[model samples]
Target: MMAGLEERLDKMELAIRKQTFRENSGRANEVNFWVFDYDPKKELEVRERIEYMKKKNEKGTEGFQLIVFDLYDMIMEYLEEKDFVNSYGRFEKRRGFDYIIRAVSTSMKMNEDDSILIRKIVEQTPENAVVFLTGVGKCYPLLRSHKILNNLHQSVLKASVVLFFPGTYTEQELILFNEIKDDNYYRAFKLVK
Candidate 1:
């Protein structure tokens, strides 16, 4: 399974490097977006493979640049900068999961914050870049691919974006980690395995 997955990743990298979107394409309308689904149990292994591939691609003269944006790290940084850690820590200590969920939902506008951060990151990326968006499992039930991609402007992001999703994609629906089944999103294409 790992070998097969690696092969798929290689193919995905090639497709991303080769794909080009027209200027008139609307947000989330271009086929430049891809999802790499994998077994949730092998998250660590999958991440390691992706990292290895990223390094390998960087060393080669592929013409396209690889940029990784980890959502977990972004959320942590946002919480730290907003000084909400102490409060969340207290909530976690006292109330546990429920309080933490409520606090996160109330404090962080997940889509808005992620959109801003992603836009900033995308804006800084050079031409012929492939942005790898990861850490979807970490932000389950909060940060969703459809929401983020729907919010992003096609004009600002000239390069392809691949989301490393630890989930299942059946038909057009997305089931994150095999738990949260999302609506059918028509914009992005699934990376063939």
Candidate 2:
């Protein structure tokens, strides 16, 4: 069991690195990973997140994007603080955020349409940006849409590295994840890995 667990963890890390490469290709920017534990509802935390992001952006690094899956409320609050207003009265203006946050639920449920939307959003990102996702766990799907999966598989070809966080999981779950990140599946999703 221990050996199996180690193998699973190793595999997850590889997949993450690969995904990161695909996401950052041809952008000519350095990608940095930061994990923060904060509640978006808290004012102080929101401020801190904004400060951190601004500091990174100031560096003007190309292709730098942060991926956050959890603590979405904090991100929302930060956006609100910056006056990017999510909703308004009569006059509604949609604001763009610097980081990408994917809850495990959204990531797992993402279909082709969602993937396209996400791709479009990413295309609009400025320099030295970050995308984040938090609260990753097994027993839950990482990506939900088979259709989106199909689309992403069609494009990704050569992902240099993959990274995965450590967690506990059952044997069957590990196997399923392994299959999802498999190299062959990259072509099917139009994603490079």
Give me the overall lDDT of model 1.
0.70
TM-score of 2: 0.28
Best of the candidates, lDDT: 1
Q: What TM-score would each prediction reach against the true structure? A: 0.79, 0.28
Give the Cα lDDT of each candidate: 0.70, 0.33
User: What lDDT score goes with residue 99 in model 1?
Assistant: 74
Name the 10 consecutive residues with the lowest summed lDDT in model 1. 19-28
Q: List the residue pairs that clash in candidate 1.
A: none
Q: What's the true lDDT of residue 183 in model 2?
A: 28
What value does the lDDT take at residue 5 in candidate 2? 34
